[model samples]
Target: MTSIDRKAAADVIDFLHRHFPRGWKDWGRDRSVSCTMARKLLIALGHATRAERGAEPLDPPSSPGSLPRMDDTLLALLLVAERDYGFGQGAHRWIRRMKIRNDPLHRDLAASPDVFAFFMELGAVEDGAWTEPAIPALLRYHAALDPLPDFDAVPGLHAFRTNAINEIPEDVAAEMSDILEEERPSLWQLGMMDLLARRWRYPEGWLAASATGPHLLRIPQDALASWMAVELIRTSRAA
Candidate 1:
């Protein structure tokens, strides 16, 4: 059996310690939690790959010519640094998603304004064709952080909203309008508008306003009717 590389393991632990100064408190005591964090970190660092069918035992380094391998015990210790620093699942996911290919270096994965902006643009798309599950997850992650990204600045958001309005039926559009008029718009409302706008194809000015404006309820009834007509014609064509 190949032995674990103690120096490589120590380096990983040291990296975590430097990144997170605090020692793992609540998260360190549980063996299971530590193991989970370690596995995720390994995946992010390209040291491990998740099995599609079921959990597989960590494989030893292929050969001396390949990268050094750490044992499960040392891997678990790496999580102590992660937990001590308050890095959560969200942070782990971010690192995994954004880690660059061809770059073996893995220590620097801090969130930034640019990363947040990219996530906002990702969430702006509502089309089933282009939608991503990660966008919603990232949005939820950012919701807990201060100084949220500006939705208006998200590229292609206007085009996404325009497309949604052009596809939905008139009745559905009316229902959406009613929902908006009756209550304050939340993320759901924003998403609905994005869909309705795909079919409605409202003017660029109006589309932009509706997206960033204070209230969807403030849109004039006549404008809403005009937008609704587009869906009606579309529905009739299919009939």
Candidate 2:
């Protein structure tokens, strides 16, 4: 449970998503299925080497594939959260029980395609995998964040005002600066996407947003200058 083998995790997900797109289980009553991908993935995660997955009543393994060695934690979590063939309810209970429910780790893991794929399988595993669906909301909140604009990309304050004087209100620049300084968190705000990925980690309004979305600071379109100013301020403060 210390560290998961990423390659092994991906191998497991690819197998299920391909073959058993409907459901995943170590052992089950569905005799119609003669193959399971358990053994290869388990072995990859440093679990015991077993016979190939077959129509066994208990602990079936998967068809032959080269799986790397890894920790069994993620795989075990999936088993606990799988649909009809496994624990069909919430993963939160298991996640909390296992002490793996930290927001920081979940947010970070969601950025990885493999780990995100694993968690995304949550309620939908037995009914079949997620499609007609984008990444789940929980995972999306944790997905790889958008990259920030380059410092050189946003216009300098002087250059901004000279060409776009009429674009914003007379006093908007000072107002934006006050908002940025007042609203900026003393912690991960400047650090993580201007502060919307908290996922119950922070109180509402702690993160800012506009009509465009939470991803952007709450500046309106008419005030793009304010957005530019916000970025410049963030850069200077960072330096």
lDDT top scorer: 1
Q: Which residue segments of model 1 deviate by more than 4 Å? A: 1-141, 181-239
Q: Which ten residues in a row have the lowest lDDT in candidate 1?
A: 213-222
How well is each residue in 1-239 modelled by candidate 2, as lDDT tens digits? 02233554555555444434543354322323122224333343333343354322223434333333121223233332332323222234333211222331122221123334454443222222332222222221211123332323433534533343234333444443454565545532343333222211111112222312211211111122223345545654565
- Writing each residue's lDDT as its tens digit, candidate 1 over 26-81 gives 22232444445544444433344555532233355222222222222222332332
Task: For candidate 2, give the lDDT of residue 39.
Answer: 30
How far is 111's C-alpha from truth in model 2 (Å)?
Answer: 20
Q: What are the Cα lDDT values of the candidates?
A: 0.34, 0.32
Q: Among all windows of ten consecutive residues in candidate 2, which has the lowest summed lDDT? A: 214-223
